[model samples]
Target: MFTLDQTLARDCAVVGDLPLCRLLLMNDSQYPWLILVPRQDGLREICQLDDDQQAKLMNESNLVSHILLQEFGAEKLNVAALGNMVPQLHLHHIARYAGDPAWPKPVWGALPPKPYSADALEERLARLQRSLAAVGSPLSFPA
Candidate 1:
């Protein structure tokens, strides 16, 4: 069986499930961020995924990059799969801007997380769901 890392569950909102990943939106409202975790059991590294799985993940990553660039108009998109804190086969997709607080730097530890308020979180979730729908993929989101 597979379960999301507790740390991730605490820090992110359930966005939806893609073909092979569980999409999550980071709780922070400062910058646009998303995470994708393979829905596989006991996997901590991308190398653990077979070639086909790897390719699928890459395609999904590209989909997210496209959303950030086209829908949000992000200046730069940062994609990483650092499992230092939570050793899950998860990837991070962050949207960066020139004058943002952590410009030219990473989003981690640059500033404390500003969790989205109830209204903000709702709006964010709705916008992201719409974005995914616009992509025409049959993503299944939480009720």
Candidate 2:
């Protein structure tokens, strides 16, 4: 059985799921940030996954990075799997621009998160759902 960490659940909106990961959208409206959390229980590091699972995670991570660059036109994409606080095996994909507030620094603790407005959140979720669903195979979206 698997459950999302409380901190992650509280900070992100459910985007959908992939074959091996539960996709989440970080609620911060400041940038296009997404998270991929593997659905296995008690996993705290990427090395914990078998080779096949590791391959799948990379494929999904690439898919998200591609979309962020192609669709969102991110100048640079910051992808990381840091679990210092949550201790879950989750990858973060953040679309970055040179002029962003965090700029040359890590997004964390740089500035307070600006959550999306009701309509903005809805639209953003819909857009991401469409983008992910459009890429068929190895990807799944909840109805």
Candidate 3:
């Protein structure tokens, strides 16, 4: 069976589940970010997904990027599936602005992760859930 890495589990809050991916809201409030983790067991690479699954992940990623851009007015959308740090098969969709912290650079190691305050976290989570719902894919944080 596949298990989420401890670091990922600790750093990200569950946002919702889709047909092919489990959407996670990273704790970092610096960027509007989401992580998509496929539910395949013991998989750690994109190639691990079957052809149909690959297509689903891609389509879902695109849909997510579109939502982030339209809702947040992002200057740039960064999507990546790097597993160097966390060896689980997951993709990151980040909304970046030209003037955001660590602009023109990768978000990794740019600054310490600033966790959301309770109120801020709740508000952001609600907004994201509502947005996802509008896209016909409502999600929920893990209780």
Candidate 4:
């Protein structure tokens, strides 16, 4: 059975599930970041996905990138699937702004992760859900 990596489970909010991937919201409040993890066990690279699965992952990732950019008025969308630490098949889509703390640099290790407050987390998740809904995504979010 598929399971989330311990670090991921501890650090992210379960936003929902698509047919083949679980949508996750990174808890860091600094940026609008989301992750998509394929619900397949022991897969640590995108190349491991079969052709159809690879296509689906890209499609989903693009959909998420566009939504985040619009919702956050991002100056750029940073999409990546680097699993150097966790070794899980997960894609990250981060919305970046020119004036953000990280600015021209990558978000990682720019500063310590600032977790969202309970109320803020809830609100951010709602906004993400609404964005997904607006795009007519079929994923089902937690109530």
TM-score of each: 0.96, 0.95, 0.93, 0.95
Model 2 lDDT per residue over 1-143, tens place = 77989999999999888889999999998889999999998999999999999999999999999989988999999999999988988999999999899998999999999999989999998998888778774556655
Clashing pairs in 2: none
* RMSD (Cα, Å) of model 3: 1.6
User: Positional deviation of 28 in candidate 4, in angstroms?
Assistant: 0.7
Pairwise lDDT winner, candidates 2 and 4: 2
Candidate lDDT values, in order: 0.91, 0.91, 0.87, 0.90
Off by over 4 Å in 3: 138-143
Candidate 2's displacement at residue 41, Å, is 0.8
- Can you list the residue pairs that collide in candidate 3? none
lDDT of 3 at 107: 96
lDDT of 4: 0.90
RMSD of each: 1.1, 1.4, 1.6, 1.4
Shift of residue 21 alpha carbon in model 1, Å: 0.3
Better of 1 and 3 by lDDT: 1
